[model samples]
Target: MLRALVFDFDGLIVDTETPLIEAYGDVYREHGVAFDRAEFERQIGHASFAFDPWRAFGAGADREALEQERRAINLARTERQPVLPGIRELIEAASAAGLRLGVASNSSHGWVEGHLRRLGLHGFFSAFGCKGDTPAPKPEPDIYRLVVNALGCRSVESVALEDSAAGVKAALRAGLWVVAIPNAATADHDHDGAHWTVPSAAEVSLPALRARFGG
Candidate 1:
């Protein structure tokens, strides 16, 4: 039986991908490098720390400087970040159903906390696992494994909801059942190994999830 539900923060819980892409573009423009939206979407999934796009596309630009610029841009745009449709309802339902919940993300703690606070979801998560909280990020399974361990649940008794292939891979590698909800930019990515692929979390009623896994 599934005792906990873990989530990915960015594209999964909140719709921050577009703003993040725009911010990265602004950073690239300042350095005279054109940002490729397609490439950015393809590469900037849950494993962002593993493949920092600043170094990939910045040419001779200083990585630390570029990261600072990106962070500043993101912070400036945080007020405009919006929660994903039905995410709050899903979270509430899951909570009411007595399922333990947590978050695992490739983003830094500040970034994750800021976004979650903006969406009034900061207190919903039982545990928050960020990039620096683990030795490795998404696509490595370490972060997700950490969340499961923290939840005090066995991997087989947990479910992970993610929006990217990297996040799905991480959860699956950690031996948790994974539910994939691909974003508009990453909808074309392969989800062959996910336990289920849903169009959106809105379609997944809490009762249905509980019926499938809680029992």
Candidate 2:
């Protein structure tokens, strides 16, 4: 039986990833430096990649002030970030069906948990696993493994919903069935490693998912 459902918190649940890229780009623009969206993309859902925009912009600018502005821009953007489609329905359905729900992310615990709480989605998760809770996060499978254990479910008996290449890779590596539900920011990410790549969050085939996984 599919006893659990694990979710990736950033791009999957909210569009925080896009705003982060935009904020960084905004900072670069203020410094008269061209921002490489592709460069920022590498850092999504994994901490293994580097994304120091000031380095690209030159060192003359006040790094602390620029970082503060970037943080403000990002916070403003995320204040209005919409929860992606079908997520609520999926969570409600999972809950009604007695499936354990979890959120595992490469982000810090405060970031993911705080947003979920603000959105009133925090109450739905049985487990919240993030970078601090594990030795490694996405692209390492440690976070996913920790969440599955916390949910009291076998890896094979759970499904992971992800939006980025790193997250998909992590879930797949953890031996869980992975579903890719890309948002605008992650639309171009490579999801070939996922078990199923759906067009968008709304079109995710939960029924098909269950049948394929013996739920």
Candidate 3:
């Protein structure tokens, strides 16, 4: 009897991560600097990471102009990026089971909301919580707390679908039952802390959730 299902946007909903990383890589390449894979991996799943390309590369690249180019590239790449497998199915299944739907993310409202709508998923959520909506972002429990409160559901009766370690940690801290479903970028993430870790989103089920942590 799970009352609600909360999803993490970005890598979990749509793979904006790959496109964004590619865009960033392009920007670095333009300046004759190779993108640092290790540093990029460390910054994944957290929005507050220091991403000053100039400081990292010791280049005189204009940050604003570089940002604009990166955005343009990302936008072009995202136009063709498809929603992840099992995402739509999960949403529809949850909706049909009378579960209130929500999205909690470390991304900005404009970013997450607009993308959700474009992907034809904005109307499915009863609540949408993002960076500014809470005091902090994922890896902090603020975003998840905001979503649970907005949906008028207790944390114990809600289920969270997350792809990254930060998202899983946040949901667990907020008392939600978490299902970790990693995407390519987050496949190496440590999900041992989650209540359940699944190989794919299709394995996330309301019936299984109710059996474990009822509504």
User: Against the true structure, what is every candidate's RMSD?
Assistant: 2.5, 1.4, 1.6
TM-score for each of the candidates: 0.87, 0.95, 0.93
After TM-score superposition, what is the CA distance of residue 52 in candidate 1 from its true location, in Å?
Answer: 6.4
Tens digit of lDDT per residue, candidate 3, span 126-195?
A: 8998878877788999999999999999998888989888999899999998989887778887787888
Compared with the true structure, what per-residue lDDT tens digits does model 2 show for residues 1-215? Answer: 88899999898889898899899888888878888888778668776456566787566768899889999999999989878888877887788888999998988889999999898899989998887788776788899999999999999999999999999999999999999988777787888878888867777656776887885
Clashing pairs in 1: none
Off by over 4 Å in 2: none
What local lDDT does model 2 show for residue 68? 97
Q: Which of 1 and 3 is the better model by TM-score?
A: 3
- What C-alpha lDDT do the candidate models reach, one value each? 0.82, 0.86, 0.84
Residue 110 lDDT (model 1): 90
Q: In model 3, state the lDDT of residue 125.
A: 93
| Location of the lowest summed lDDT over 10 successive residues in candidate 1 | 43-52
Q: What does the lDDT come to for candidate 1?
A: 0.82
lDDT of 2 at 123: 90
